[model samples]
Target: MPSAQDIASKLAYITGQLTAGGTNAQMKAWYDEYKKLNVELKEAKAMQKKNPKDPNDLQDPKDLNDPKDPKAT
Candidate 1:
């Protein structure tokens, strides 16, 4: 699976090609690749958000500072 950045770069290139115009078949191929890369980029971003690299970046679901938390006292 390509990283989000890689997918984004490919999508940008495809967009440029699409805007530049081409034969029907060529345009269709580029459009298809663009769509595929867009989907991959979304998925990669979602995965990246779901699994951050740094453990410290994750937040506890139940705040220890909440008054309701027994340890809050």
Candidate 2:
């Protein structure tokens, strides 16, 4: 899977091509790619939000650090 930044760059390039004008076939292809990248970017964002990169952002409910865990020291 491409990173969000890479997707964004591709989307920008597509937008530029669309704005510059092209044959109907070329325009259609670029437009399709743009839509696909848009969807991928959204999915990438959702995944990033669901899984944070920072270790501190993660929590294990069963870990000994949990105050409510009976086995916690």
Candidate 3:
């Protein structure tokens, strides 16, 4: 099975081919593959989000830099 990046690359390539006047058969094939890959990528992302490896991996509110702070200068 191809990784998400690989699938994305293939989808991009197919899009370029279609834009360059690819045949109908090629367009159909690529559209199906693109849909499959898009779903797979979304599912993978959802799973990853559900079970992150590190608790601290989440965004931290303190990480934001306040622009109005006098000491920011």
Best by lDDT: 1
Give the Å error, residue 34, model 3. 0.6
Quality of model 2 by C-alpha lDDT: 0.80
**Candidate 2 wrong stretches, greater than 4 Å:** 54-73
- Residue-level lDDT of model 2, residues 5-50, one tens digit each, is 7788999999999999999999999999989999999997787788
Worst 10 residues of 1 by lDDT: 55-64
Clashes of 3: 0
lDDT of each: 0.81, 0.80, 0.66
What ranking of all candidate models by lDDT puts the best one first? 1, 2, 3
RMSD of 3: 7.0
Task: Put down candidate 3 lDDT per residue, 15-49, tens digits, no spaces.
Answer: 77767766788888877877887887777566557
Off by over 4 Å in 3: 1-7, 54-73
Q: Lowest summed lDDT over 10 consecutive residues: which window, candidate 3? A: 52-61
* lDDT (Cα, tens digit) per residue for candidate 1, span 1-73: 6667778898999999999999999999999999988889999889878886633333455433677768778
Q: Which regions of candidate 1 deviate over 4 angstroms?
A: 54-73
